[model samples]
Target: MKKFLLYFLCLISLTSCSLFPRDNTKSVKEHTGKKAEEHQITPPDDKEPNHSLLENTMELAQEGKVATSNFAVHMNSINDVKKQWGPAANTDQIGGIYYANYPAKHTVFGYNAKNILVDIRSYDEQLHQLTYPQIVKTLGKPDYLRTNQDDQIYGYKITQQFELRFIVPKNTEKVDHISLLSPNDTVATTTPPYILPIKGVSKNLSVTAWQNMQNWRNQMIQVAKNHQNFVFLNGPNKKRVALTFDDGPDLMNTPSIIETLANYHLKGNFFFIGEKVKKYPEVVQKAYTNGNLVLSHSYFHHDLSKLQAVEIKTDLAQTEEEIFEVIGKKPALLRPPYGAVNNTVITTAAQNGYKIVLWSIDTLDWSQMESSNIEYNVLKNIRNGDIILMHSDDDKVQTAKALPHIIEELTRKGFEIVDLQTLLGQKAYK
Candidate 1:
């Protein structure tokens, strides 16, 4: 079975595609909401769409010596498979890969005589399900869970495996069973060595577009590191340019900007004033729902560099509280009013746990330039890494008119535009 699965995976690999889902818009943070558990099963050795598991397993068993058999398959390389199963494991002829682990955190890999992963019933303590005694009886008493209020239900940490958590029901002392893959499971995968081919596009053009995106994203990170402020959003490949509209949550133009971004499958960062969010809760919600990063621009668009420490703190905190009250997420990034920042501003921003973001490129669309000029200037000087500044509301006529062309022209020149949150590599405010 393992050999057959391997061969199947190999054949799939030849086509430059993956069976794995590729949608990445979902944030990596764990969602606590109730969800149905999804379990994945390996498909047939052939792409003919077979779903008979019993028959498949039987056939694999008949094809003995699968261990030594070089059946080309595709889920991942054999070497990669070997890494999952460790050394000291041997393969047998029954078909699939099998492995075992002792009481300690070590793995043994091989095909069992029955050709299945070995999960021996070491000690059954199902009765320990909801009691403090369960912990003592199973994995020994907790060193920390007992002391932590949040972890009273169940907690266990392996040397390298995840820190186990049991979400007990409210008012219940007993643990409600829960399991998680260890933090090690969350290690970032190395960048794919090659681009997966895209269908319906010229192969060369697809590769070039992918490379341009990678370059642009890397450049955004490099530029962000030089400044104390700046937060990145979205995946590195999507786009890195921040579309900030100062003095908004504007009722007039905010909706249009939101509509435009949504149409393009993109979002932006809104450095809104406190007054705006309080006044237009709907607009604030719209931005958040659209995946835009709603950050603090101050209670009013006040220059932080000129404010006294107390005034600066008051302004920042008030803005943060107002924004959070409406959006349910505190702003982690702040754009100083008019992009002004100094030592005082920097210290104040740091104290508030907010990074100050500045733009690398300004479109001056606020001047309400001809949409043609706005479009031309932005595209002409655009590079792999850039942050184009334009207002969401003030230059409504010019910005709205220039939006499509700016997108088309920049994209044509091999530049990928992205949201500020992605460009700065920071989590969204929410």
Candidate 2:
């Protein structure tokens, strides 16, 4: 009986141990079923998984897996943006790109690798008013902003007290571009207050230089009224004063002369070197538009009297081409380089359809004389029909200093300053 009880107990223990498996593989279906239930309960829309997706996306972008942020979208008008949030704005052009208002407060337009308008942004402050010529003079470019069948848009911005963006457009046939906007939010419709063409003289100039010339003309008319004809003059009496200038349309100095002349109400003949005009086309255009005659000094200030015939021809042609390219008016007047024209030089100029113009009185303004002395000599030498010569190069600093006195003295005297065109009764090429 004892043996049977012990055996029975051992068997019970063995069966109990077998029924409960020692390894995790006790019921494979039950383990899988539990895992599946846990997955279902976790939910697809949980925050932890969503966060992981965002982090992965950011990391992909940082790795340059994408060319650009898919967040990019076009903005037609800036008015749509909230002023405070200030979303990043940029413009992309071929070969170039720039961010808006990164370092400064002025409205800025930057060029891309292709030198096209890549970026534009608002700026703070009012900048000095810039003319089209001034713009070209400073920038040496014209950005093709937009174009349609009727007109082409050119973007111009000024950096000053307040940033101003100007959208200038040119008609297909006209040489001038009308201002489409101003800093004052003034919409330029037919014409802006003071605008010039992108690359040439206009039918009329309303720039500061032109206004100055007009003022000078009015003053001259009030006095002698006889100072008619453009840059040079030869009346029946042949008693004329040719107001001739050499070397300029300087960006700073020329404008002052223009303003002084306007104050006196006069115009004069400008003998420009090709290099200088190329440097400051806008100033030259201002001269041309104001009815101031533009004449050639030389292609590179080489005296035609000394150069060979081929050299002279090449020089003349190059200068003429530059002038025509900027003013759309080829010069018909030639002032031999350094006033050194001989008969051969004259003949060459004549062959090229240019009239050889010589000065009657040299002011020697090009010399480093005292400004007052220069002023006195010019004033003292004035005659009823004298051709007075001066220079426009900044190196001719005396001329700039003496200008106001000269104009004031001339105004006091009876002689009127007139351009060669009105004086010569011949059409000007520029």
Candidate 3:
């Protein structure tokens, strides 16, 4: 059950969660993909976890008595759980998820950065629990059955938004614990909060490699706030970052990047040049069908900032046409070549229903840098909400080689690799 967050939510929500298999016409603006900082879940008032609320809401149930299962499973948010359970007895966090355990109550609650309850669990040995035979007799076969070395998990659809599971020991039939979880809930790390460290990659390193680009990144963010058509530069500071490639759909590097991304089950944003799409239609189509966003770079990778308004619009149209022919849809995003833009280019893009996509991390992979420096540029400067920039042109073989390492390192550090649509919660197509 523990896997990619995007696919998990999508499949569980019937493709309604806008992560993968997203609705083309619907904007996923509601879900803010902000990740939580690495820290223990603590009481907001800086007080210890107490049972005051456990006593206060002891009668909130319709049955005129406390129903711990109902309170633990049905609470709307972490705040609701906190109001009922006081605070967690112990807390741990990994990859934007918080695990707050209440041992005496035999309950644990999981929440995302938004404080939305992702799951709840209870494991009280005192309570007479159901065996596998009893569960099958009472519930009439589980909706899903999963067998592991130590246990067999039986899951039932508890409601539209959540599932109820019972874990039974593999050798013994007796139920071990119960959980109420949504598809959005990622499995907590085996050691609770331990994220494996990559050998050469550390997020805490201070790398002043591209100090000018960093400064310019700040300036672009400020400018983007003033421009309605500029959708986003980077996402909120959190555990997720987007990887985007540019100037691609080449025979070698583009397909190589796409295959490598598929190997890791990650989706990338490909701002491909239109003219190249005609030359490599299959490569472009493969990226789209493989779940990558094939957005617009330009018709011929010209700098729109220097071009006239009509020229920019023409390039947009030509780019849209080429992509539409290859992928059968029009992209709504435009990453102006060289990240160069002016008032006219912004206005033209707005008039054309295209949002300009920019980056926060510039990898400079187009410079034919060695694979080590390429990895260094990304991992050394990686942060929450970063929009990474790299190239997939045929000449940039080093980029294709550096990609898998970057992805592996990122995941080992527990950063979710998401697409622009998921990170920005914006529409990818017109």
| Global CA lDDT computed for model 2 | 0.48
Please list the C-alpha lDDT of all candidates, in the order they appear: 0.49, 0.48, 0.66
Model 1 Cα lDDT, one tens digit per residue, 298-362: 99887787899889989988998998888788887777876566556665665556666655555
Q: With candidate 1 superimposed using the best TM-score fit, by how many Å does residue 360's alpha carbon deviate from the native?
A: 0.8
Give the per-residue lDDT digits (tens) of candidate 2, residues 1-430: 5554322212211011121112121111233543211322222232222333223323432332211212111211221221332322222111112122222333333322222322233222221122333333333334323332223223333321122122222332211212212122111111211111111122234588556545543433322211111112222234446667888868777777766676767787789999888889999888877777888888788768788767888899999988998878788787776656454564465446666665545565654356766665566655555667778777766677788787667767755666766665555673
Q: Which sections of candidate 3 miss by over 4 Å?
A: 1-218
* C-alpha lDDT of residue 75 in model 1: 16
**What TM-score quantifies how close candidate 2 is to the native fold?**
0.44
- Model 3 C-alpha lDDT versus the unseen true structure: 0.66
Q: List the residue pairs that clash in candidate 3.
A: none
Q: How close is candidate 3 to the true structure, as a TM-score?
A: 0.51
RMSD to true structure for each model, in Å: 20.5, 32.0, 20.0
Q: What's the number of clashes in each of the models?
A: 29, 45, 0
